[model samples]
Target: MDQLLAQLPPSVVALLDKWDSNVLLITIASFLAWLVWKVIYNRLEILTQKTRFHWDDLILASVSAPISALIWCWPATISLGFILEDYTQSKLDWLSTLKLMLVIGIFVWITMRLVTNIEDYALTQKNRDETTVQAVAKVARLFFIVIGALTIMQSFGLSLSGLLTFGGVGGLIVGLAAKDLLSNFFGGLMIYFDRPFKVGDWVRSPDREIEGTVERIGWRMTIIRTFDKRPLYVPNSVFSSIVVENPSRMLNRRIYETIGVRYDDSQQVSLIVEDIRSMLESHPDIDAKQTLIVNFNGFGPSSLNIMVYTFTKTVNWVRYHKVKQDVLLKIMQIIDNREAQIAFPTQTIKLDLENAGEFAGMQPQTEHQQ
Candidate 1:
């Protein structure tokens, strides 16, 4: 290789001898590196546009690999000493250090970029479940960071075992600092694997009273959008531990109503219950398969309480409300026709005092002059 290098034309050799110190060489090298990267990356971008695969688009969108390659090639042209070494000892040492830094930078940059590409690809696979994708992405990122850090350390001539020993202590401290965060993370994983609730589920937790649609299942918490347009973020750990009531998942909805009748109107109570049952059975929305129960539940202080239990054909809230409204209107009409009134809580109090007389003889009680 040395003989071949020496055998070149005088002008070419002269140019190479000057290559080490010539500012023009540095500029040309930079321009060529940039030109190569531009051409290759643009071609990738064009290819991405022509293809229909989203994964390919993601790969093209992150052009870090090409950029890393261009960066790695730059110092090789001037720093190998054989290529061009004209500087004094101090300048050469500086150049060497710069080259080493560049090498470390390229190593870390490429590793992270490739990791990003893999994560993007993993996200594109719809066959993989959402929880799997999240876990994979997290694991991939951690792996990339560790590899990058180790590569940089090794480039500086440091042993990885020493770093790992230090890292063990550091990791312990970090774990202690983030105990709750880790708990939430693992809780989220359990929730995902257990399949207790999914996106778009309506869940009610003992700690939280949520009546809304699920918007997202994130790493530490689940987001629910309430009916009032407010967003609630409940920790996944709480959801995993608590009882979750999913109204949407119910097969059929039970409609229970308590209607009261005046105590004196006892004779009409049975007739009203029978009429209500008939109305429920004849209603278009009632599920006939479900057993309907109508009974005199109990007697209140001022009224007879009747329980009407029936199931609606559908579980949708709006439809259930419509059916319930119709039934309620019919019950009111029947009560009006029978001239019976719905009872309210009532109490009568009698005030009697021994010798019921006003203070200081202002007035005196008189029970038929007794």
Candidate 2:
């Protein structure tokens, strides 16, 4: 730059000499940095967005502004160093400290933005579940953060030997600092070992309001998709404290119901029960071996209540419902064969004999006639 300026006319050189060389350098660098920042943020960013790769776009979008700021400050830092060399060592001692702090701080800031970008991008992807994506991203981010920190420290004249000597105490400090994270990590390990549930399992917890299909299980959390199609993010630590019921692993789906017949059909109760038992015994869908029970449980006010307790051969939710419908329709056909009608809710009102004359039009039976 000095040589280039020396070739200029004497008038221009005199004009330029009015300002200190370092200050002039900084001024020129600042203007150049601004132009570069505009091209990067406006032009290059647009170009990156057009690419098919997500990493390319994310890297540019997340780190561009910080990098531009770093560029602007770099020239000033160099000028400051040059000026500090002429001053007393004690007076300019903070320069190295400032550079050290600035570099580390910028790195941390840039890394955080990068991690956040990755997380957001991962969620929009359909190929992987949220739990798995976040798990991999977090682990990678942490690894890079540690490595970057050490690199920055080394660059700032800090020795790795001094850090290694604090290993025992550092471990304790890290454990204490990340107590909840470690708890979740170990909880994830327990899930893998104990195998309470796996991906695609329909799990519900009596302890927590967690009921969903396990989409994916990460190191720190699990992703569940509820019946209503909402995504649920639960920490792995929660599994350790909660009781999860896995219905997907069940051998059969239960079909338990109570059917009633009008009192008029009391004579057909025994026949109906026998027919139902016979039908269940021969039914292909019903598991007759699994403690099947079809009997007249008791008498109700308006009808004889019969209990139907049995399991289906299949555990599939949709198929189980279809099987249940078939069984119920068959029972209806049996009742029709015996000329019995299913009873509905009914009530009786008894009025005083003398007062009954005043309310003569009122029916004694509420839901059904006797």
Candidate 3:
């Protein structure tokens, strides 16, 4: 083997000289690393299928690319020393800094992957909504990226004290410049922790005349999709400023209506009122636990008003509407069966000839008198 190497071309001999046993060692190490990764991945895949905790599989999948990159890059980086032996120490130091930076980058990548996996797992557990989980994950990723950047800077022999001082001053300036933005960000954090309303929750801000389903909660704003299907982007600060009504949180929806009966049906009004109350009490959808009131409120200009105040067992809009319609229809049927009539706005005017002396004087004489 030595004689054959010597018989090679001069350039080839020099190249072989630079490429020493370390190259072979690096290749073997890289292969072993790859093999280990493959074995672990396959085992995790099988385990995930059998285990209840499937998040482990997700985590493995997320880190697979980064692990592969690290495995290959580590070996190549080790071989760089043998290849660049004739290079200056300063150039080699740069390479070392680059390698450190790559290591920090890989750490950040892994951290981000873990954050994503954790977010996904939390979502499946229903502990938080999609928007909230994503926001939290992004915040975590930002934290890891900042730490990774600081680590890379430190690896390059950069002082963090000066950088921290600069950052402090710069942060203050940015805070002052973007006061509203900062307020919104903190407001979003408040919403996240307080959980006033989540995605898909029906919310209405009476002060702002905003009523919609929460689609997403971002760093600075919350997106609402209105009933008309228009997208509304409201700042998080606005939510803090306004009164937000989350109707989705209500256990039951309310139904308050006034039914009018004609004055002629006054005798049957009491019976009608009692029957209506009975109907509400017996209705399956009506929430019996809530205050249910049926009373003869007062006499209106056109009719006698009967007040029906009750709550349904459902908070769903469509279901509530259906219940309300059915109740109203049943009330109408009861009134019809009792031979009663609903009142309408009407007016009556009368003319008395005896009281119209001025009009009588202006009228023409009868034919016989003429």
Candidate 4:
């Protein structure tokens, strides 16, 4: 690189040094680097578009400017150091450290940018979960940042061995002081790995009153959008201790309801049950492969209870309700066709032999009082 710089024409060097314009040199170098990176990135972008994979595009895009900046920085810093040493007769000792830090920072920035691009691309895929992609990206960024920080510290003459020992002790103390916060963070990691539920899932806990659609799952807490439209903030650690039911993952929505018919319609019970079973089996929305039970559940005081247990093909809430409504209406129509009605409570009154005469005498008086 020094040889290449020396190979420059005397005319150009003289032009640059006429007014000792170091700022102009840096500006011109920056512009040339930008133009070169722009051209390289454009070419890489076209090539990536032709390739079968997309990740290469992300890598190329992420590394382009950072690499160009690195290329520009090496010579720029060396030139500045030379220029300053000639004028001041001493080198800026910290300039070397600054360059080291800059290199480390640029690499970290590149990795983090690449992670972000991958995260966004994953989100664009229909099957990818937004929460999982974001979590993975965050972990990647954190890893790069930690590495960069340690590298920078090493550049500054800090002993990594001493730092590690101090960090271990300090980490232990911090852990003991913030147990709950750490627990929540680990719980979040567990959530990401186990995937009991993700953002936008309908999760309900039998152990606690946490029933809602998960809006956001963070390191410390999860934000739930309850059915009542209120936001419920739950610590992630609570999920570790409780049982969460993810209704969104269910393949079929169950329709378990007990329909009642008048006792007078007992003769029609067999036909009604058979017809309901047939209707559910042939229904497009119902999943016949699942448990489809339609039978007389019990004998009520005034009506006969017929339990219908079945599953719908769709797990969507709105569509499930519509299907349930249609099934119920069909059942009602079948009952009406059989000349049977939905039963209502009824009672019959009777009088004893001794009270008959008293009632006969009181009947006229009660009627007159009314």
Model 1 agreement with the true structure over 8-71: per-residue lDDT tens digits? 9988888878775565676576677777877887888888788777766765555556464655
lDDT of 3 by residue, 17-58 (tens): 764436876687798889999898888788888877776777
**What's the lDDT for candidate 3?**
0.87
Q: List the residue pairs that clash in candidate 1.
A: none
- Whichever of 1 and 2 has more lDDT, that candidate is 2
Which residue segments of model 1 deviate by more than 4 Å? Answer: 1-13, 16-23, 64-136, 165-254, 262-292, 310-327, 330-370
What TM-score would candidate 1 get against the native? 0.60
The C-alpha stretches of model 2 lying farther than 4 A from their native spots are 1-21, 82-108, 170-185, 188-238, 246-255, 262-338, 343-370
Q: Cα lDDT of model 1 overall?
A: 0.75
Q: What count of clashes does model 2 give?
A: 0
RMSD of each: 7.4, 10.2, 4.2, 4.3
- Tens-place lDDT per residue, model 4, 227-331, is 999999999999889999999999999999999999989999999999999999999999999999999999998889999999999999999999999999999
> Can you give the lDDT of residue 344 in candidate 3?
94
Question: TM-score for model 4?
Answer: 0.86
Task: Quote the lDDT for 131 in model 2.
Answer: 49
- Residue 159's lDDT within candidate 3 is 94
